[model samples]
Target: MNTSDLKTKIQNLYQDILINLDIEKIDDYFAENYVQETDHDTLNLNEFKDHLQKLKDVVKSLSIEKFNDMLIDEQQRSIFLRYDVAVEKVDNSMGNIEVYAIFKFNEVGKVISCRELSKAYHEELEGLANI
Candidate 1:
């Protein structure tokens, strides 16, 4: 795939699947044999689906604030993204997080694997440090 196509797919995967918590559409973006690593955890396709399901159960809402950067390597069929997102928990607590992910696509252009890292903080807590 070209750079634009890869970028769009990644964005759609984030907004459509992750933010929307649409587990049903997971297959549209991932290959049957998919794997993902986040921090110290590793998950296969089923495990990833379960993780999203759990998130859906606890998260009231999720929104992407902005995409900080995106780098595509057509030769390697991989892309890296850095973005910020906001999530509201079931109890209505809000968390802002920055995410960095590298995705590798299979021969057929489906996402085959990913490695990701994220850090969270409360935007409302920023002013407390100065008080």
Candidate 2:
């Protein structure tokens, strides 16, 4: 819809869903028809939930290390964002990943699609990132 609304949604996604490990809240941010394309694989809404579950199981903490970019297209309700992610694994090992993602939103403002690329430069993150 609007840039501010989109920004709020993105912030909530990281703070309330990913950082909090609240899988149930995902529906609030993502559409039922959600699909994500990643370098490795494609995931539907159900698969995305499973992926989050796996992350919840293995990740002790998650934080945004750096926010590189966020560009929104108001006409299309789409955005391109790049950020660095820092995570503490269940084993207490630390890792960092750089992620670039494109997200498309539905009329009601739920995320309908996402295509993402992520890479870990450090060994500590390589294994944890697979989940």
For model 2, the run of ten residues with the poorest summed lDDT: 122-131
Expressed as tens digits, the lDDT of each residue in 21-56 for candidate 1 is 899999999999999888757889998888888787
The superposed Cα distance between candidate 2 and the true structure at residue 103, in angstroms, equals 0.7
Say which candidate scores most in lDDT. Answer: 2
Clash pairs (backbone) in predicted model 2: none
Stretches of candidate 1 above 4 Å error?
123-131
lDDT of 2 at 21: 76
Give the whole-model CA lDDT for all candidates, comma-separated: 0.82, 0.85
Candidate 2 stretches greater than 4 Å from native = 127-130
lDDT of 2 by residue, 1-131 (tens): 79999888887887887679799899999999999887668899998899889998888999885569999998999989999888888999887888899999999999999998889877878745446
